[model samples]
Target: MKVEQIYTKCLAQGAYYIFSEGEAAIIDPLRETQPYIEKLEQDRAKLKYIFETHFHADFVSGHLDLSEKTGASIIYGPTAQPDFEAIIAEDNQIFEIGKIKIKVLHTPGHTLESATYLLIDENGKESAIFSGDTLFLGDVGRPDLAQKATNLTQEELAGMLYDSLYNKIIPLPDDITVYPAHGAGSACGKNMQKETIDTLGNQKRTNYALNQPDKEHFVVAVLDGLTPPPKYFGMNVSMNKKGYKSFHEVIKESYRALSPEQFENLATTESIVILDTREANVFKDGFIPNSINIGLKGSFAPWVGSILVNVQTPILLVCDKDTEREAITRLSRVGFDNVWGFLEDGIQSWKEAGKDLDKINRITAEEFAEEFTPDAVVVDVRKPSEYATEHVEGAYLKPLSDFEEWVKTVDKDKPFYIHCAGGYRSMIAASILKYNGITDFKEVDGGFGQIKKTKVPTTDFVCPSKL
Candidate 1:
């Protein structure tokens, strides 16, 4: 029994390719299926099955496309309502592909249709389980996402989750490696382990979800820390059910280079999307107008996957010359293969081309303190809990997740200053402001941490000031 884990970093997703004898099976494939196709061809294995753990809401799945291309059957739990032809998998249903025996286990908590696949070797012993979102390395899937419309509350689903974890996942042998569909930065699970794979034994000892036997407490704990789902989640989920758009037959070769004038023309014509992969502060200082800012600092792939869905859209990358390959590889992880080209010499190329650049206004903590006025709106773009723990006096709490809608709530004419825990999110917030036509905005140079470090005078808006 040979198994390979295909990690798609852009979506924080992992798919399994199981090969034995002359057959191959893929579990939880991403929207782009070419990589899998190339792998199968290279291995000389005929594709036999494509499985989806659930109707994913985070990123589009590629089961349908693979099935269409390879004449392979698509498999999902019975409760799943995928539009294309699919085998309704049931508990204990066994199937054979080459030398591997696959068994499906219904694990319903992440969604109504979630399932875990147990792989048995030709010798009849369990080898691994593709846990999908039901069980991650360090965290269990969040129950709130798929429960929004159903009569079942998060509490009710969490109870089901407890049963599934204790009854099905726990009873398996400790050595059976648990391969989840997602990892860190995935919205499906909070506090997901950074590692892509872990054994059941390790997860049992270290994962908080597995340690808690008290169902009530477990339910409360998992439900409490979930971040808001991305704005594109609903559209992605709906499209997945109907199946994704067809993958183009022609794979365009990635652009090797582009002159600054050519890049500027592409941006102006809206023929290509400019991706600034520089540090957030660098981007905030100055960037080409209308470019989307996704810094290379943290979770670059998942955030890019969340915001940019059109895989074929031509991309113009802007990064320091040193980080260009890192940017390309990150984009490739999410299957964004239609890169038109990268800016030559990065932003310096634009300077040489004499292209116009836009700069975001930034102010120091001391300057913000002196200019602070009731009418000058201050926005906190950190997490809600962070804002609650500490914040500038009278500043409106508008998390970066809530930024777009939050912008509407504020008076557009009022000048605004934005800050987060540090400078990263402030720059993101600033770029979002620029895109939304909010120009009279100043981002705090060092963010809230700097404000605290400088001991700038701040009144407590939520609590009385100590000083």
Candidate 2:
């Protein structure tokens, strides 16, 4: 038997592949299906089932397309009402693949349909549990995401999560492996460990959620500091629950290569957005006017999902040469399937055409310190939690996630300086500020990380809870 964790770093999501005796099963797949198809071919296995823990909110699942192509049955836990066909398994129901058995443990907390799949090896010993969002290595999934759909308060969901963990999961074998759906960078859980896999015994001892004193305490702890879910989350969940456009169709429609003039005309004549997915530093040097830079180098998909709320927003890409497909694929992961096209030959084509360009003013942290005044306008685009912990003295907290709303308040005439923890988010902010015609600001090159190292005065670190 072979079990593989296919981890996508950008989304911080994990999908599992289990194979035994020429039969394979996929759990919680991404939007792209070709990779899984290729894996089946390589393993000489026929896919028998696709398992979904819940209707995911982060990225559209590949279950529909994978099942259609492979003739595999898509399975979900009880109480799931998907628009498409799927087998809703009861709690403790079991399915077999080769000599192994997969037992469904209905552990609904993250969502009403959430479940953990228990894998029993050929020797009939419990080998591992694909815990989904029900349990992460260090933390449990946040209860707030499914509140509206379930009509249950986050505290109630948290209580259910505690029950799911304590009654259904904690009694399992200590040595069994625990494979969760997400890790540290994911918005699914606030305090997940960086490690994707851990032993159940280790988790019992180390995971804070698992060690809660009682259900009430667990509910309070789990609901402590959840920021709002990304704007695209609900849209992605809808796409997953209902069916979505085939990835093939999305790719075919999005692969159009537009000439510089065509790209410019589209940007000017239509309501389409220009998304420049280059490196932040390179983007700051120069880019097309009004292009929002959510660079491919950072948490590109989540940032895009947060900033661009509408899934159907038409987008034209200004990517580095050869990264157009990657940008489109990443965008599609979050249900952004309306990519109009990419600028053919990239920004160089526009430069050659002598089209107008825009650049953001940026300065090193040292330079910013030397030029700093006590009352200079400083914008910290880090999250409120980060800001509350410590920030430059007198810096205004305007998180990048809420850039669209807060950006409107920036005065066009006032010169300001903006920074994030590192340069990535600040560059994104710089691009948006320029796009909004507020170009009098300077972005700190290294963000707060470097600013704190300089002579720039920062407030003493304060715990987020206190604020």
Q: Which candidate has the top score in TM-score? A: 2
lDDT by residue (tens digit), candidate 1, 322-385: 7876677666545466677788889987877778888888888878877876576778888776
lDDT of each: 0.79, 0.92
TM-score to native of every candidate shown: 0.78, 0.97
lDDT of 2 by residue, 36-101 (tens): 999999999999999999999999899999999999999999899999999999999999998899
Sliding window of 10 residues with minimal summed lDDT for model 1: 458-467
Q: Where is model 2 more than 4 Å wrong at Cα?
A: 461-467
lDDT of 2: 0.92
> Which parts of model 1 are misplaced by more than 4 Å?
148-151, 249-282, 296-355, 362-378, 385-396, 411-417, 444-467
